[model samples]
Target chain A: MRLLINKIFLALSILSAGVGLAFLAWILITLFMKGLSSFHFSLFLNDLIEGGLRNLIVGQMILAGLASLIGIPLGMTAGIYIQEYGQGRYAALIRDLSDIMMSAPSIVIGAFVYAIVVVPMGGTSGFAGAIALAIMMIPVVINTTDSMLSLVPRELREAGIALGASKYKVIIDIVIKAAKVGIMTGILLAFARIIGETAPLLFTSETSNYFSLNLGESFPSLTVSIYDLANEPEESSRDLAWAASFILTVLVLIINLTGRFITRNKK
Target chain B: MEKIFQKLSLSSATLVFVLLIGIFITLYSAAKPAIDEFGLHFIINPDWNKEIVVETPSLRADTVANDAEDDAIADEDDMILDEDDDEMLLDDEDDTVTKTIYGGLVPIVGTLLTTIIALTFALPIAMGIAVFLAEIAPKNISYVVGIAIELLAAIPSIIFGMWGLYYFAPIVADLVGGYQVSLLTAGLVLGVMILPFMAAITRDSMNTTPAVLKESAYALGATKFEVIKDIIFPYSKVGIIGSIILALGRALGETMAVAFLIGSIFVLPKAINDPTISIPVAMANNFGEASGLGESALFYLALILFIISFAVISLAKFYFLKKAK
Candidate 1:
């Protein structure tokens, strides 16, 4: 009787897990059915009003890339500081502030940028959007860097110091190399997050029906365009929205998979 | 050279302070025009349109100027509107804006209502799955089930939104015999969305209960149910509560999926079947049409959302810190 009950319970676990997976599968299938109908090379080459997501695609890549570039180094440095040299009251305050920033609403980050960068700069420029995305990126990188640095064997650091290495040299060579894969994972995950963000770009980076390469100009990202198009009354716009959503999702998933791959490869 | 490098590092650390200052300065300046126009009452009062008409004189001056000096007077008058007007406007607009801002309350309430309902439904099922995996599930099946549950966390929110829109809404409406885009349907869909987070967290928490606790309970001739109730549940209480709070945080901030599923309406709902707007949904709904004061109003709404998420996340952080200590 006990054995039979155990078997039933095991089946229940599998059943529950199956239910969750099935829901995810259903969601993906629906996106493909709606979005794939519009899939074409032209969708990647033309501007939105010109019947493609070309500008949006480029804008998203550039802005998110810039955000990652700026955010990763600062966050890693802060993380290293907290994990290595930090102690007492100041470190505690920095840690708490980073936590608060991490879970602050995405839209608030947008508002903060709108107030700070976009408003002061005189318009909703891509640079303002990048700043907002960078804000989102910072907390993720900080957490990952801290964790990765913490995981480095203490003996490794001591050994570096014993070999006549300065504290700076020890961090750059021994500690950073040891935590490289984990730090990379954090960066990829941060990229995945900023890529799908729609709110911040709405206020700080949105462009209307025009294509330009200027960083100071407002440029619509794929996520913002998808959001705008989805709300339109036109069927064509809605279809395009689905396609944009699909593209964004696929891009993020690819980043997530790459992060997973990097972590797994290191292991 | 070493001193130069240290100075460089210190300056870079100073950049974090610079970034924070930059953020504050930008918010203050961007909000300046509206802030100057509204004064302190801007946040409290909701009458966003304080219309000050600027009459540019047509070069053909025969058109009557109410006063020849009224143009400059109007500019000065715009500045000189009495604190009394501000006070009265505050009373009237405060209620209205509060309604619109709180107009989100229906959605907020609906979201909370649905989340509770989802948790009510999901908790027992999640607990059952956790118990099964920890104590009863065969080792091979357990690994597969665990991997599958973890994968659910990886699924993007937009996909969930699309699925809810195309598939779940209609079926839920048919089965539940109510409005197609009611709270119940949103709740059910969100239940599915949150189940993975709850299940995985709960399972880990349950598994972490020292083996000796459960073993001792079982040796005392406790049945499986008794063991779960007396030993496992008590042991994992803090973690279980923390997991639930984390899940609630996710549900609160969830934008795309809930936006698609919950029919976005600005008014408060008197019934569960009524379409409602959540804070995130309200932000999305207004983003397309927002201009001028309408745009600032949306920013205000976003600020409120930031407050809600900030509060919840801080709570979670506090719990984690306590546990860590």
Candidate 2:
């Protein structure tokens, strides 16, 4: 009876793993097939009426760039504070609260930004959307940076302090330098993540039809455009969504795979 | 200057705490009016008229501006104004209804039910994969499989929605009683989306289960399966459970995939194929034009979802801490 149960368990494990991999392949293949066929060269051009993707791509860049600008610095600094200087009940509180924030439903972050920024301003804007994504990015960066900084050898910090260097100097010069690659990987993953987010921008950015540099107005993003277009009744609009999804999926996969490679190489 | 740097670092950490408090403040203050008006009935009462899904744009932007012409269609789903109770204020001059009575029971129920279904599909399969990667597979195969799992996770929720809605839903529609977009479809896609999360943490904990413990079991004449069941699984059980709870949190808050695949309607599903919408999906679909009571009610729903996520995550954290100790 025991031998039979063991054999059955082994068969079930292999079968489930196979099912998981098969689903992965199906999702990717379907995405690539429809996405590639829907693709058009005009997508990269900046014509206003035909609904080109130039504005969408540029909008994603501006939004993600601004978000990273705010999120990376705050996240890295907070991470350093937690890993290097966090102590007692205070540090423990920060650590736990941040973990909760990380797990908080991301759509709620959209609601929070909408309540704070969009309602007061009378409408959605690129600034509000960027701030929402930055909020999502911070917890990820903090988690990664804190873990990476903790990985840096304690002897390095001790040696620097013993050599009469200030704590800040030792941290900046030795600790951050050692953990630079890991920190970059974290930022990359965070970037890849917020770039594909649709919910936060659904009401916050509110979607734009044309390319506009005004941070005061609603903006176009690849993901939001995909959301709007996918819901439309028109075939052309649906194709546009597919093309955008293809690009977004390919970009995210590349970033993630690169991060994985870097980590594996290091270990 | 160096001392100032220290101060800056400490203050930055303090900023994270302030941000958390600020989210709570803004969310609570925004939801307060609705909470005061509706009380516990907001979650339990299932009589949602137009405020449940709000499909038409007559509610868009300024409902007051469009009320005259839009009132005809708006009344199709809403009878609160038509009922004309003495409780209603009855804007005699403008003829505009001031409030849309809101209850989120359907979406809230849908969110929990779908997440439960997703976990049911995801947990055992995810555990099976973790066992294979941790103990059964060779190192090279495990490494390749592991990276593939990470890539599976990297595909965003929206893309999963796209694939599931267009490709997978049609194929399974007959199986799900002819409704293309149903709770089962959403749960299946969500199970796929969260598989990596459950498996990754489980695999890591299993990998770290102190090889000597497994070796001793083997040396005592145990089979491979017996060793895994007796030593490795028992050791990593807490971490495995923690990962499942964390994945449950992810499944609960899932928006785009559930939105696209669940037929984008707020209904108490009576069958496997009945159309439904989760809280996050309902919030996403209706948030754009929501105003007055509708806006605050939406905020209240978001707060409820946030609280659920908070409690689930904290539970997982406790499990993790205990496991670490």
Highest lDDT against the true fold, candidate: 2
Best by DockQ: 2
Query: Weakest 10 consecutive residues, lDDT, candidate 2 chain A?
Result: A46-55
lDDT of 1 by residue, B43-153 (tens): 444223344333323422542435455444444444454334445455554332111111233545655676776677676667666666666778998877776665556
What DockQ values do the models have? 0.32, 0.71
lDDT of 2 by residue, A90-190 (tens): 87788778788887888999999999999899999999999999998888888899989999999999999999999999999999999988988888888
lDDT of each: 0.70, 0.83
lDDT digits (tens) for residues B244-283 of candidate 2: 8888998999898888888877678998777888889988
Clashing pairs in 2: none
Error of 2 at B141 (Å): 0.8
Q: Compared to the true structure, candidate 2 yields what TM-score?
A: 0.91
Task: Please provide, for model 1 over A1-267, each residue's C-alpha lDDT reduced to its tens digit, 9 standing for 90 to 100.
Answer: 765675565566557655655765777687888889977779988898798998888889989999988898878878877777667776566666676677666766777877667767888888888988998888778788888999999999999999998887888899999999999988888888888777677778885566767888888688777766776788888888888877877787788878888998987
Which residue ranges in model 1 land beyond 4 Å of their true spot? A1-16, A207-211, B1-148, B177-179, B211-227, B287-300
Best by TM-score: 2
